[model samples]
Target: MCSLCGVLGGRGHWTDTSSHPEAFTHVEQPTRRRERQERTRLVNTVLDHYGLSLSDWAGSSYVLKTKTGQTALVENLTELWANAEQLTKHDFDPLDEALIDSLAAKAAR
Candidate 1:
């Protein structure tokens, strides 16, 4: 599917909501946007280890890109690791001890 169509028709992933879907109505739009921004920032911390980065794309999807200009539009976190590995030719393990240590060190700063 085309990127535009995918963005328009995509279903919300479980991670997209801070609370129950029904309660999402009580959240303000800016608050939702900020949540997404925070998620992107946190994801970037991991992606940086692989020499890649992610950015929020139009508040609907994520743009994952490599240092040499390769890019992919990630629809959600479910697709993030796969695309990051493909783009960087490196495996990403969320539970890898080294990654956990790096994150812990960064958090300590």
Candidate 2:
């Protein structure tokens, strides 16, 4: 599908739900937006290792881009990782020793 269609047809991912699923109503829009921002920040910490960055796209999707200008609009974290690998030509192994070590170091600091 084209980027525009994908964006227009976006659906909420399971991870995007709040602890109180019913809180997904319009009244909770602000809270949901904040959550997405936090998620983007945390994801960026991992993407940094691969020269990629992610930003919340209007609180609906993510904008993933490489240091060299390649980009992808992903609907969720699962798509984010797959597209990240494609853009960087590198595997994004969560269990990668270096990645775990890096995250550990960050937590320690």
Candidate 3:
């Protein structure tokens, strides 16, 4: 596996997914205390930066797809947040093509 998969796999070890199938805990950082809290924070940032919200997406659980959806959201939101750091950019805009493919798949509607 490559870096993305490696990261995903590591995150997998952090949570209990037996009941919820794709459940995961993000790589804990000083900034993030819990996985869902981090995701909630992520949702707010992405919504604010891109002027979009998870309310725009069709599914209830984007995390059902991957452990990195928050970051994927951030990456996706990059074009809208040109100068923000990896975290505070408030962009889930899928900047890299590979990241787009692995995460949100071009976001066409």
| lDDT values for all models | 0.79, 0.79, 0.36
Q: Which runs of model 2 end up more than 4 angstroms from their true locations?
A: 1-11, 19-30
**Predictions ranked by lDDT, top down?**
1, 2, 3
**Prediction 3 TM-score vs. true:** 0.23
Q: Compared with the true structure, what per-residue lDDT tens digits does model 2 show for residues 1-109? A: 3342454544456677654477567554557777888898899988887788998877666899998899898878878887888778898999999999999998799
Over 4 Å off in model 3, which ranges? Answer: 1-33, 55-92, 96-109
lDDT value, residue 72 of candidate 3: 32
Name the lDDT of candidate 1.
0.79
Candidate 1, which segments miss by more than 4 Å at Cα?
Answer: 1-10, 23-30
lDDT of 1 by residue, 16-70 (tens): 7754466466545446788899999999998887788999999877899999999
- Give lDDT for model 3: 0.36
How do all models score by TM-score?
A: 0.79, 0.79, 0.23
Could you tell me which residue pairs clash in candidate 1?
none
How many clashes in each candidate? Answer: 0, 0, 8
